[model samples]
Target: MGFPAGLLVLLSVGALPCQPITHGDSAKQDGHCFQVLPAEEGALNIGRHWGAATPAATVHIDMSKVTSTASSFEFRTLDPEGVIFFGDMGDHDWFVLGLRRGKAEMQINNIMTNISVRGGQRLDDGHWHRMLVMNEGDSVRLEVDDEELLALGHVSYPIIERPVPEMRLAMGGLLLPASHLLSPMNTAMDGCLRRWSWLNQTTTWREGAALRAKAKPCFSALRPGSFFPGAGLASFRPADLAGGTAPPNGSWGLEVELGIRAPRQTGLVLAVGVPDGSLALSLVLQPTAMVVRLGNWTKLRLPLPEGPCLDAPLRLRVSPTQLALQLGNHGGTLPNQPPDFQWLQGTWLGQEGRLFIGGLPDGDKTPRPQEWGAFRGCLRGIRVQGHQLDLDSALFRSDTIWAHSCPGAHEGAEAGRRARGHGAD
Candidate 1:
């Protein structure tokens, strides 16, 4: 209902004076003693610093109807120790709202018009309030009901940083915490988010996935190859593998070997293609490596070696039975595997009748952290053991038993989806 009983409008130590704008006070005056100020001028307006002592209760000011382009709305209160806070203090937190996308068209934080109102809400308490903020482009007005609370044309917000606005558009809802911005809030609202509506009712899912237990391996992603530019590469042309089909148990193979100056650790991702274009796989890596398989994107975390020695490279040899992972120094052999490591095997990459390697299955590339050490020595070759189930030589050409596909040639072919046991060079 009304602001918690003793919510006082604080003023700076040398500012005008501490004034408590009560709910019953008339709000039609300019600097009226108990009267709240206009939509453009108030003791909390920019250039006027204010502070007050607050009890343990939460405090919130309703400024949902002011449209002022002034700097910022500033207020402060005393800490429990009686220390005076400068502006909007106590365990202060605030969020400002630009006009909604349909209400007013604005993408970034830059003020395009000269006079507009940016809505705002300030809360020192723990409860929620029906806060509103209106920005008229240049002037921003903050109010409660129609009562003009803080008419701020210009308030200094030196610490607030606005991004370049490349993500999905969202109505602004910032929460300023007691000190600086709290980290937990960032964790809660960090990803792409949108308010649900009738038009967007179809979009309910967020991050993460619900995969079946038995999907097959359908795709592979490798860095430092022709498929990927600048130190990394990935490949999944539907027509290039054993099963060139879009979905339904298409057999696919991928191979990656360390070259001269190769990375110490490399990440890998595998997806299978099923009737609905879904696939699955079991992943493995050394102690120095990390992998993330979430939704359609599988991330590989490769930590480069400290200092320098010879080159150490890792290779993945794909076969129907298992994935042969080999790592060695320069031209040497990889270390021993755990006795039961060979049992860590399964069909990789089968989801939604489609497949993804390192990123999203549909190829929506989101940048994740990846690093591979530069190789000092050269890598000789890679060896895979498997027979192509499909006899079509065009899709399964291999000098070695492991047939690989041609670069950029696996876009779409019905035969690749049905074939089996073909490999990568």
Candidate 2:
């Protein structure tokens, strides 16, 4: 899931580490050959041995996220300058010094204390070359894939307290000339610097969600029959109220409220219905609104209105056994028989209705006189505080019935009925 940070350079089979550091006679061993330079100029060569290639690609080493300790960073490449070989037996050119710091002036005799080789595996033929740099204590060891190479002592300047955690970590710089042989695609030069750390830490984004900054919520503006200052919220008239005033009578309506996370998936689902009509309260995912079912709770069966009457001023008439629906007269009804344990038996939001009806249908048979202070089944207004519904302002009239005969008592009811009949004709 994660990648290391470094640029990998390409090297051919028999390219030089530093082109200027020429060899006398070249020989091969273990399926690879190396250019041999005499020991006479070995010290001098080591000092002048600047990495040969100025790789075309660059790899970024992100020190902030390192996870590997014994990790090996390899670059298969050849410097345009030349090649320098290194090995233990001195008989085989097992590795190439792809990168190195210039030799320093030492006061001691024949002892190069500050000399360090930071490269790996060499090339024998004009083929793939490998360079490995490994971290060991305060120093890095250079080696070929399988050969034991020399270990150089490290001396850090005051400016560089820790191993320069972030060296340009790049390839194809001005110092090293570009390789000639079919080198790796400049973009493919990749490598990584490893560090020590746990990978499974929660990022800031995930932490915020877990901390309740982004919590789950739900709302039904259309169901409660109301609107914000913007557009018409859930508009409806008295005639659209579901569970008609008369027994076994029903009406339908529609609702268009914003649902943060609609109830299509899980949780307690509730829908608003128009008066006794075919369409009951159903959730319309795309367009923010609810369709209604038109029927009564009869042993788990509720019939639905049909024929796609997606117009204005839909109606609902609810009865004890059946709920009827009249959508502007394009009479379409849906029937769904509620189960014995139906908490949300009927409700609706009026989108496509002649008259919008707003109401509450809680299972309360009778209450004390004082409790009857508010009305139900028709929403006149709702108060919102801090973007949340204020339960205190939710008014409900328990007895102001808006049935077929006395539809004018509620707003939008009479007009909606006329619209429904006209819609059918």
Candidate 3:
């Protein structure tokens, strides 16, 4: 069968007014309405904007011809995490291509092989990159710009051996309710994708792509840290976390470093312990005090200095012998605290390996409200255990967690406000 003949498109929304099918509508002679419209001109812009009303920006391509192997695409992004494409071959064999920690990644899975390869980091500097992905005998090869991936960057696999039936490249993320175990950025992308060429498939990008949400006039996304309104929450268990569960009890250690700007009086800033049990460790802000609870036994409340600039650098470190906290030079350390909170030595963090930022809602409410009210503040640039967390790409987040919502944001940075001309130079 012909390439385009086997191809079918499934984008979400109508990008334009009624346009005739280039495949030619059979009902045109009868003067009846037909389906579809032309693709947006230039690079296709898509994002990971999620809600009950906001569907995924998914693009599906047919890749069942095993004899045809080469494919290429061009990309540019400011986001460091988000699903770019998830290909399902229907036999539990699949592949994902996207950005992981600002580096290009390709994860392949088959019967006996499950491996990942990463490219150079910091690829998200709003720069354009050309990628070539093709089969190299028993392994898959990936190249960025024109440089071949290094030795550890290629994997032995069965991808080219069998046909690929179904493949999806969501503009910004994976089409979940799927697995996020491989790529943790199970969220939307803040970037642009264009000039996709797959296996000499005979079709224009316009005709091949299934447009979802209107191709937004791309903009510079304001990522001045995520603003968590009262009653907001974001949770995740990163895939890179070793072993997928809490580590050995005695070896358990935690560190939290955050730049906080809390204008509100009371809010739960961060919690890294059992949700319902008394074994929780939490950081809560109340008017003039920053209270840190280490389990149910030790609670330290430090009064805030009276002044403006409701902002402070907060750091919390937990070890076997010491509980260290620093809030803008106003915190004290408690030594030999492990014996006080026995739960600290054995299981400071539960087996779930979960970390919650912001407020947790009660399950009894219709649209669940916060348990002890919410945290009305912003957590800027959080680093936990030496890893930076991307709030926009969490596994789950409350509706109120937002960007460009923090007060004093410059409105001039909004989408469609500035002009940017892209060149491959």
- Which parts of model 1 have CA positions greater than 4 angstroms off? 1-227, 230-233, 237-279, 282-311, 317-324, 329-425
Cα lDDT of candidate 1 equals 0.24
Native-to-model Cα distance after best TM-score fit, residue 26 in candidate 2, in Å: 35
Q: Which lDDT tens digits does candidate 1 get at residues 1-425?
A: 11110112121111122232212312221122111111111121111111211111111322332122222222211000111111221222222222221011111122221222323332211111122233343333444334544454433232212222111211112223323321111111000111112111122111112111111111111111111111221224334444433234554444444322322224333233332322333232322542322223332334334433213556554433333444453122222232222211222232223322322222324233343221111122222122222211222111111111111112233222222311222
Model 3: CA > 4 A from native? 1-55, 58-77, 84-123, 126-170, 174-221, 236-253, 305-309, 319-322, 334-340, 349-354, 364-371, 387-408, 411-425
TM-score: the better of candidates 1 and 3: 3
lDDT of each: 0.24, 0.23, 0.52
Candidate 3 on 1-425: residue-level lDDT in tens?
01110011222223332222123332231112111112223455545364321323554554554345666666666566655555554434556676767777766665646766677745665555676666554556666788875333234433444445645544454444545335444455555555566554443223244442233432222224455545568766533343334566636667888877765356778765444443356777877788877765677778776653357788888776777789887887776366545565344344543566786545542222143456765566688776667666465676445432232222343222222322100
Instruction: List where candidate 2 sits over 4 angstroms from the true fold.
Output: 1-55, 69-124, 127-130, 156-165, 174-425
Best by lDDT: 3
lDDT of 3 at 28: 32
Between 2 and 3, whose lDDT is larger? 3
TM-score per model over all chains: 0.21, 0.21, 0.51
Residue 22, candidate 1: Cα error in Å is 60
True-structure RMSD for candidate 1: 25.5
Per-model root-mean-square deviation over C-alphas: 25.5, 32.2, 12.7
Instruction: Give one digit per residue, the lDDT tens place, for model 2 in 1-425.
Output: 01111111121111112221112321111002111211111011111111233322222333344343233322211111222321110111011233222111111001112232333332311122233444344443434444545454442111122232422222222222233221211221111111111121112211222322211111100112211111112223323334222234343222222212111111111233333443233222112233343333422222222322111333333333444444333444445455311322333223332222232233343111222111111122221111222211122211112111111112231221122110000
